[model samples]
Target: MDSLLALLKKKSTGQGSFALENIKCDFFISDFDKPLLYTFAPFGEASADTISWGFEFGKNLDVNVIAISLVSNESWYQDPELYELALNLGKLANFSEILGYGGSMGGFGVSVYSNILKIDRLLLLNPFSTLDPNIIPEETRFRWYQRNLEWDSRFNDGAITCSKGVVVYDPLFKLDALQAKRFKDFKLVKLHGVGHQIPMHLNKLGLLKRLVIDFLNNGSDFAWFYKASRNRRFYPGYFAWMQSQENIHLTQRRKATITKCQHSLKKLISSKPGVDSVTGKDIDFIRDLALDNESKDLMKAKMLMEIALKLRPEGEFLKMKVSSYNKRLDGPDL
Candidate 1:
């Protein structure tokens, strides 16, 4: 962080640069008359050499850029240092407009500070509404950090202050979906099955850069984004994450169930229990693999179908495969 601060100071041509104890802000002046993109760093993204999240993308833009970052992942930008820096930044040479952008934790930062920065428009990807346990006791993903961080009531909910913006998130990610619901007037782009890392998935589809640029330049086109994101069906990472989440949900559901025998949930549960979100192309692929292996390798085919059934708990083809394969496996060796 010290190294990056030194570099920013060397490149800064205006008074829009400040490095406080926890927060650091730097301006990459391009065209003063053009808009300014204020971007915040995501969690665990602090680097000693690099600026922040949107530095590379900002460089290509006609607007000036302000990259803000927390020195560590400790505080969620709820610090006296950031308040002082925002005050200092407000007094700088004005641009034509102000815009903010970030993903995940950085997304939370952008929304929380939008009012203070007077942001005209903003873009957030999988942003948290608040890490305040009292506010969202159901959010159990980041427990350790939530307990440690100061969830100052003053900045508890960004949705209250962030008036207008574009929010992109996966509807399948229940926790993120809950967070996305807190915002009032923002345009919500539901990219299903992409998981919490929507930016990464969009980037994988070669659409992230253009999406940001187009949204920042004009505004979000919901139809176009959805159409473009259909390509994720071919990406294995999408299916992998979907399967992982399904597994988690299945485990949770099993734990929630109680048996009359009072046995452990693990002991009573089916070994090849099904999961809900394992639908679509992944199921087809698994089904095909299981069928192909059934004639060549009975044991392997049964195992493959077991995995398939776990992903698509209600898949009829998988049920047939399970029945057929189990009978074959039970038969005496020839």
Candidate 2:
């Protein structure tokens, strides 16, 4: 964490600053002398060192950044002092443009605070509109925040009226999609294959730096950003998601969508490294898909289990699965 802070401090020309220790947030005004970018760090990023590290990428864009790190998820919504400090910083900057940015919990902060900050624009990626489970029961991701919610009516209301902004998200990610719908005013930039981790996916694709620069330079012009980020089509995660969608269509008996999905899956499986380079959970998911798809084809299910076992050789659950498949193949008497 010290190293991360040192790296950020070394890159930017401005001196490091801190809000009241009670607020538990950090601020670093970039030396770039460009428009200020006010970024709210996501939950768990409670310190300057632990905040979002994407500021380094934006440094070259000649934008000044004020990275606000929160000590708790409830801090932003509950504390009026934090909001006042953020707004005052923008006022002090005397810059014509001030943009709010964050993803997930941070995204929620950007939306809620940006409205209050009255910043020129916003760039929210998969932001949660409300932490209230009653409003969005399907959103099960942020359980920590959900359980500890302070329930501020000011921020919790299902409305984020940004002057101009873009909400980038994956429509396939049901929770994020629903949240995006709540922000009916912002331009929606749907990146279908990537789930809740849009920034991570974009960083992996080497598009995040350019995308941030573009959005910072040209406020809510989503068309240009979308065109530049079309490389998502070639991403392996995207293809893997397509394959999963096809499998779903096949299960649902959606003949037309199934046919297209099949062709796409086949092409992806043949040429792309779908789920192979990803987590073991994804491999387990494929095994479950195989078992669910071909319950009668014990051989196919066993093959998938073998593959999963190879990846997770000591996985007891997988071993059990393999045993179950073997028993199914051997017959009830055996």
* Model 2 misplaced regions, further than 4 Å: 1-13, 19-26, 30-33, 45-52, 73-77, 219-230, 240-334
TM-score computed on alpha carbons, candidate 1: 0.68
User: What residue runs in model 1 are displaced by over 4 Å at the alpha carbon?
Assistant: 1-18, 246-334
Error of 2 at 103 (Å): 0.8
lDDT of 1 by residue, 254-286 (tens): 434422122322222233433333345756776
- What lDDT does model 2 reach? 0.61
TM-score of each: 0.68, 0.63
lDDT per model, in order? 0.69, 0.61
Q: What digit string (tens of lDDT, one per residue) describes model 2 on residues 1-334?
A: 2332443435544445554544544345555346777776656556534534345444445567666666555554456666566555534454557787887777777677775666777777777777778777887776776777665567674245555777788887677788987887677888865677677776655555556766787755566456535555545566565546322323445445545655654443443224435465666686686577345444556655665665566879778988876654432110
